[model samples]
Target: MKKLWNIGIAAATVCLLSLLNACSLKEKNVAVLSLDKSFTTRSGFEGLLNGCYNDLYFLYGKEDFVAPTELGTDLWANVGTAGAGFTLYDHRLVTTDGNLKVIWGSAYSTINLCNTVLYYGKEVKGYTSQAELNAKLAEAYFLRAFSNFILVEEFGGVVLRTTSSTVEGVDNAPKRSSEKDFYDLIISDLKFAVQHLPVNQGLRGRVSKKAAYGLLAKVYLQRTRLGEAQEYARLALETAEELINHQTQYGATLYTSDNTRSGFGKLWAGENNKTNTEFLFIQAVEHANGYNPEFWNRGRTRQFFLPDLGGRGGEWGAREGSPLYGRSNSRRFKPSRYLLTQCFEPSATTADTRFAESFTYKFYANANKEITNALATTYKKDPSVVGYVIKGTSAKATASVNFYTQTIEEQTNMANDAGLAVFTPNWTISTTDKAKMPMMVSDPSDLFDPATNKYKDPAAFPDEVNLTNVHPALKKFSAPLYAQSNQYWMGDFSIIRLGDIYLVAAEAALLYNGDKSKAAGFINTIRKRAALVSREAEQVIAPTVVDIDFILKERARELAGEHMRWMDLKRTGKLTKAYLMQTNPISGELFDASRHTVRPIPQSFLDAISNADEFGTNGY
Candidate 1:
């Protein structure tokens, strides 16, 4: 047992947990009631089930909860550093850390709700069909499995709570279960989900049979090390192939051609987030209201890994209107040097459509917007001396423009599409071209120093402007409309999608056997979809040889900030060391395999438990 969270259950506990916001039947996204119903009617049963799903919003969209998953990963670091700092394993990452407490408490709360559903669901009688009743129960099973899956992966070898927390005190089950026990329960629940869950849950964002299959595939791949590693890999491959082979049956298709007006940018272009068929499962939010609008307003997936664009005076529009620049969020998880250099520079010879789609390569201007020197300096505006921020100055760009891309090439005739700011970290844009361009330019030399893990000397820009102001921004979850006052970018968060499934299938085959060709084929399915149409052939892997390293790299390129990098590294034994090591540098620098794998048991939970000494902190 790495850690134990005494899921002390009581009526008061259930009531207190229920007080949190959840999906409403009135909304278009995930819908259900607050579960005031006693599960006597069909609506009551569904409401209770939906409440179980609500916890996901607490984890996924919430900032503190996301810190553990994204901040300490290989692909991303703090917005200013070359590698991760505190979240990796600094002293600040303690047992009393609020983020850890929130995670442990939230997961157990969701599990308790599922347990409550299983206990009282039989009383729910208004079923139109047997499948409906089965589906309802299956959803409960899946939700429980999902929460426990998070528990095991995060804290390791947790107790499997089946029955509702009916007692008035702590759950009597004290001993922590084995990792195998946790997976057995997870697999059993998911198998039931596969058997009963419909292809379409009918409501948008509801988990389906296909969603269960995708999740099952990922679980098996992670479960390889416990025992029967090869067999688990085979099961993973088999399950993932089911989705890959017959995606149409499950109402899914990968966005292959990123070519229309914005090229690969169409995939995450905000307008198409709801209609993106490639999403197997997502935390889809409505355009207007998501969950309880006011309370859930903090639920955000925007501006993280995004550079401080707001600081650059209103080059990009303010976030109140549509087609505007995304709002200034507390941007965390800056891209690591590895991600910028090794990962997405057209990894193959082909023009990788993903680089343009994965990031925001261009920024537009906000014409006629007033600027103040004081506001400019307060905003930490880069190039504050420019006309855009300082006002009446001649340095501001006037139109939407890009640095290296052909969208807005050259300094001449840059009328409707002008460049206010350009970020060309990899490109060696010549001084002549840069001078001719109308915007402030930030190349690799001007931004944060990867080797030093520090921002470059700011003497080049205005006293208020620092080079850290310029870097690549992740636009995958960007939604400008979702960024108004009281609105965090509440767009649909793609949890397990078709792109990730292809990689799962690829990795599973290679792990099951040395089948590089089969793995390459699976990977190419995604690569081709991510490539420029004519150059698709060039994006294909040679298939001569493939290994875990290649698979890991592909996963990083495809699924970098999708809330599972830590698990990917952990499951593969790649998480080791506590400081910079030659083998694992960016993410795993502070990852101590012994203690860092499983987080510390929340002290609040420990304080409540009677067997405190017997069940000590999980080696924190």
Candidate 2:
């Protein structure tokens, strides 16, 4: 027998339908329960209401998990097996497709759950905490809008469900809502949430009024509602700037330079929630169910480092090898070359400290651990710095120079330890392999095998890990300085940051005030932070007015790989054009632009519906 699940319509739908009829029996039941529910009670109605909160995990954690954002835009590099399919636009994914479906399905699932809660919530009588109940309800509204934002952006129009469709004879098939209407609902919900939610949250992961306003600004920006965008952006700036300016302990800050074991590179090292203020929404990594970093490291029995396939190590390291080596089964996300390059002036020689801070390829190696020297009853105190040399065949060759000034035995040991000889072109010491450097510590350091190693005097030792690889490891989300491999619990992912908002405001001022200098100032501000020579020095950059097209591209360069790429492209009607790299794997060719912009709606949805016309835009 075919069974029909009575999933309720959205809260909006209930309100709309309520006007047509005074109060249906089902509606009365829900309304009565809404007014009677209690936060502390374990009643059936309260449990269902609590279920609405569960929708948040699905909304923030799984639905838009870092993959889509990372791959959609060019901010992140796709080095692992998981990225190959998504980055290239192949839907043959076991995990990602499931993630997409969860995003799609979870939105509607929560809508129904919210509908039930709101309906029953209105009628419930568990009193004394009206403020708490209202706050919770407001959160529910914000989540529903947030979910819809993803749906409308990814798949376009979606069935605007508002109330539970539990009644046996109630029509379950709802028509697709227009995009404008969808945004309208989203804005309305966020506005209401801002009014109701507290500015501060007791828990780290919970959303606040500031977050609501911040998201509202984003929605307005996407809709091209400049005035509204400005208003929301200003509100967000006011709310968050204070917290940031105070330099409160709540927010996370990167250490540009530090020598402690828990230094700049190991930010994501521990289970401690150190930087929560800046993180608006984050996926929590459970104590036992944390991410696996070992799966991506090199020379491990479990997984050989990058450029290697399966058990056989490859020529170049795979994209994620540096950060994940010697770690657990999980891996860290890496920003892309396009992202790094975009922040700089088109000229390679451009100087920008802000851009420089994004990455550093210089360091002083600790002599004790990296290598050893034998001299008069004492070894050299530290390992010498390995300077970076760019001596590839051509400027674009992207190759590193191998400076070999070592004895045959020293070179041979390194090669043997890495399962490859020192003469091999791609054999290089990685950030994780710093401990393997005999010169990074005392002369007779723990890093070297004394029997086969030379540095004998244990007196002198080196102090920092120097840069050796052409591609330096990222410091952005590194595990904190002292954490062991398995400590990567959830850290906050900033969907919106103060830096980006400044850019947005600058663009808005240029558009609204015709002040090109304002926009240039905004771009320059970010550039200055990146340690790059300011665009101000370039005559071409100063006169560059904030054209919509320029702003869009700038957003791509600045925010690529952060998960906002596809939506921005879609909003600007450039998704198809930007996907110039959407190519086929087997054939190794680009996909037709017309067929690549939007994915076909799930086949199952079309097949289940009796009339395809009723569903919505079929990309027809």
Q: Which candidate has the highest TM-score of all?
A: 1
TM-score of each: 0.81, 0.59
**lDDT of model 1 at residue 563?**
81
User: lDDT score, residue 582, model 1?
Assistant: 33
RMSD of each: 8.2, 14.2
lDDT of 1: 0.63
lDDT of 2 by residue, 300-335 (tens): 211111221111111111122222222222333333
The digit string of per-residue lDDT tens for model 1 on 326-384 reads: 44456666666556656677332336767666776555443333334554444444443
Over all chains combined, what TM-score does candidate 1 have?
Answer: 0.81
Full-model lDDT for every candidate = 0.63, 0.42
Measured on C-alpha atoms, candidate 2 has an lDDT of 0.42
> Number of clashing residue pairs in every model?
5, 91
